[model samples]
Target: MRQQLASTFESLKVRNYRLFASGQVVSLVGRWMQIIAIDWLVLEMSGDSGTALGFVMAIQFLPVLMLSLVGGKLADRYDKRRLLLVANIMWLILSTMLATMVVSGLATLWHIFVFAGLLGVVNALETPVRQSFVSEMVEPKLLPNALALSAATFNAARIIGPAVAGGLIALFGSGTVIAINAVAYLAPLVCLLMMASDQLHRAKTKPTDTRISEGLRYTARRPDLLLPLALMFVIGGLGFNFPITLALLAKTVFNTGPETFGILTTMLAAGALVGALASSKRRERPSSHVVMGAAAMFGILEIVVAFSPTFWAACLLLLPTGFFMIYVAQAANQRVQLGVAPQFRGRVMALYILVFLGSTPVFAPLIGWLGEVVGPRSGLWIGGVAGLLAAITAFAVRCRKRDVQISVNLRPRPQVRLIEPERPTPAEQPA
Candidate 1:
């Protein structure tokens, strides 16, 4: 048990990662609080219009879709720590501005949209650099654990942030929450400043002539890389719009306020926390089958949550929904990061971020519109269906590529299994 615990948190033994993780824990909690506040503020301002919320989300992620690749190129050529410091400073400034606007009662929906877009631009640059920076902070063997622990920190914040924000919003209003988040940015900035640069496993800087197209071409040739990227693109574009979906569901379906919404979000985060911790125990990169299987399970759970009869039931269901969601993500991320060449890590991860998050710009508004037109539960239904289809498609394509057969048996406790192609005897060889 002691050895297992040590292996799970092995990355934290690295001083740089320990510092980075410590600062990130504080900062991410604030960030998640800010997200909850922003979603709530949008709902209150827009008279609970899911479409408006979706539009804001779209604006926020548009820059990620457009500029993440460029950000990746910059990461490849520059110092990631310095880049992240700059990004966090910008975040502090922006969050402060938004807080002041809100507190002064001068904020409009357009003001929120503008700020969201600006933050999105910063995120485009920060995300890829941040994702690839894990490798620089720890040894190669510890990469998977580091990534998983990083996710655990995010989800832990997810669990804490919303619960705290919900209560804070109830008492002091969202402006205060926003202001607090602005202050939280200082933690990471200070952490970055204090990091010992000599300790980083920094990749040698690439030449200025390195092109974004090179990353694309490299990904095109590797099936191992392609499968996870493809899954992320499909599932990410269609299935992962929780901010818009959950807020709308709470307001329209349950007729609840920020507190209940926070509870719902927290439940999902709780499951995600469990998933991240579980993933941290894995010493090796996960297989393609594991990634797809988790996705399928997540989809099924989302569907179950959609059909939930009560608010508490939906909350209970979100736990497993969140688990599969993060499990698939972590598995796919480990696969891509482990498979890529070091020089291409930033660019390839940018593509991963592009597909996983950048696609939000295209899908967020659509899901929001669907919630308004179809039903409050429509987003979950659509997400679940998309996940199921994406997983099934990936499985079919993989089996065909390997010349393998697949079988399903239902009579004796349902099971689906892959059957490998048989190898020929030595006599059949061309000797």
Candidate 2:
């Protein structure tokens, strides 16, 4: 069991990955704690306005939509380790500022918005760079495992962070939780500084003549990447708006408080953690078919969860919802990363992040509005339908490509096999 457990977590076998993952576990938990606090703060300050929460969320990702391409280029041009260090430092500073404002009782709605926007700027640079940086921590063969483990750690933090934040908020306030998060940024910064420079899988230096549109063009020409990205755009835009959806559900649907909200979030994270761990155990990379299938499952689950008659029932359904969600998510991530060449990884990943996150700004307000005007269930239903449509579209594209390949290869070619005569020479027969 011990050996099996170690093998299952093979990415941690790498010294660099071990250090990085450990720090990230701590940092991401803190990050999630901050997120819960911020959302609660917004709701409190804005009089439970879902639109206000949506806007804050949108502002946080707008920069990623605008500047991720440039960030990807910078990731390719600079050392990832050093770039991450700088980004972490920026995050630490920003977290501190937010903490101070809140603790001092001077934080306003505008202050939160401004801080979110600035953090969005930091994330634009950090997301793509960090995506590409994962490859440097482990061997190429272990990339799938590493990526799965990375997702697992993130979801694990999701479990701990909100639970901790909810308790902290009850005992103290949002300010205290935010302050705790400010201290949490130290883990990743220290870990990055401790890594050996020579161990990193550095990209070859590229000529300065490369254009910013290079990654866009590269991704545009490949159906494998283009299809998954389209799927991500649809699902990520509407389906992944959990912060907004869950918060509204807790408030409007269940009429629950922060503690119950935290429990629901933890439930989703628990399922996601399970899915990610299962994904990590696979030795081979997942196919697009697998990705689409998982996505379809996710869509179906979302629709089911939307109609749950009670909060407990809804939470029960969210377990499998979270499971398939991570399966689809990690599968798409693995497919894209494995398909792209190393040189373009940064830029390609930027596009992936764009679809994966940036599109949220475009759809979040709409989702929030739907939740308010129609009902909280409306957002889930729309997201589910969108996910189903995206999956069906991807399936059609995959079939079309396969049919085209079959037709192209149907023409007969001359047989090149050498005949082995019964009357072969004795020397040849013996050999």
Candidate 3:
């Protein structure tokens, strides 16, 4: 346990990555604060249209579906550090504009929605770049540790961001809190500029004859890679990780104050941070079966979370729910990265990002509307159903594959023990 603890901070031994880690910890907290602020702001502005609130969430992620391929290509083609620097700068500008609107007392729901979409665009481009950047920041052996550390940093922010946002909103209002979040963007930007440039890995993008189809073709041919990718989209992307549900529950079913809402998110984050920390210490990438099993378990927990009668119960349940959700997500991620060939990694991963992040647009509104019409519990039930279904399907796919492999193993071979008539004739001839 002590060794794992020591090794988990392995990435931070790299001076540059350590610096980057610190900035993101602060920045992610701000991002979480922005999330709570926006969700609550839109819910307040629109009354209680669960579907509308989900739309607000969906629109933010729409860019992932639309632009993630380009983002991946760009990440592969450009200097990741520079791209992040630019993206952070853009976020700062957008956030400051949001702040300006707040200060002028002219902010509206559209402003939040529009900025949310803008942030999504930045994220679609930025995330792939971010994922790929860790390898550059550390030695190959420490890469997993770096990845673990990064997840830990994000989860830590998750733990802190909501509680702070809730208190800030309760005390001051959402506007100044948003402005503070905007200022927070600068931390990452400054960190990016200061990082050691020579240490980063620069991926060379081969100018492709088939640029558009490249990412798709890579996945179509490899089942080991494709199956998990598909499962992740179904389970992780479309079914699990229901922020829309979180928004709806906080606003409608609970009819609670911001502090209570913050507590809910904080609990989820607490679980997530723990999950991240635990997974980070693992010496090897977990198997697909583990990932799928965890994915299914997450759904079951969501169903449990759905029936909770009180805030603390729901909050307590969120811990395990979050732990499983990220495990499903990160497990799939580690498998895909380790499974694929490096040459096709850029676009193949582009598709992975497309499925992983892109599915938000298609389902966010659906889940939100489910919560709206059926009540908050509906999302937990429907989302749980969707998650369990995906897991069962993945299990079936695994079973069918095993059955095929066994059939092949048991298949008839060239005769070894018997050729009775011919052999008798040969023996007679020899006699």
Over 4 Å off, model 2: 207-209, 404-431
Higher-scoring candidate on TM-score, 1 or 3:
1
Q: Quote the positional error of residue 28 for candidate 3 in Å.
A: 0.9
Cα TM-score per model = 0.95, 0.92, 0.90
The segments of candidate 3 whose C-alpha lies over 4 angstroms from its true place after superposition are: 203-210, 404-431
Taken over the whole model, the C-alpha lDDT of each candidate is 0.91, 0.86, 0.77
Of the candidates numbered 1 and 2, which has the greater TM-score value? 1
1-431: candidate 3 lDDT, tens digit per residue: 77766876777888889889988998899988988887877777888678778888888889989888887777666667888889989988888888788668798888878888999999888887787777678776676667777888998998899999999998987887788988998898888878888776544454454264775776676676776688777765546545677766776778777888888888888888878877777656567788789888988998889888887789899999889877777777776766665555556666788888788788888888777677788878777777888888888777565542222233466433322232232210100
Candidate 1 stretches greater than 4 Å from native:
204-209, 407-419, 422-431
- Count of residue pairs whose backbone atoms collide, per candidate: 0, 0, 0
User: Model 2: per-residue lDDT, tens digit, 377-404?
Assistant: 8888789889998898888776554542
lDDT computed for candidate 3: 0.77
Best by lDDT: 1
Instruction: Give candidate 2's error at residue 29 in angstroms.
Output: 0.4
Number of residue pairs clashing in candidate 1, backbone atoms closer than 3 angstroms, sequence gap of 3 or more or interchain: 0
Worst 10 residues of 3 by lDDT: 422-431
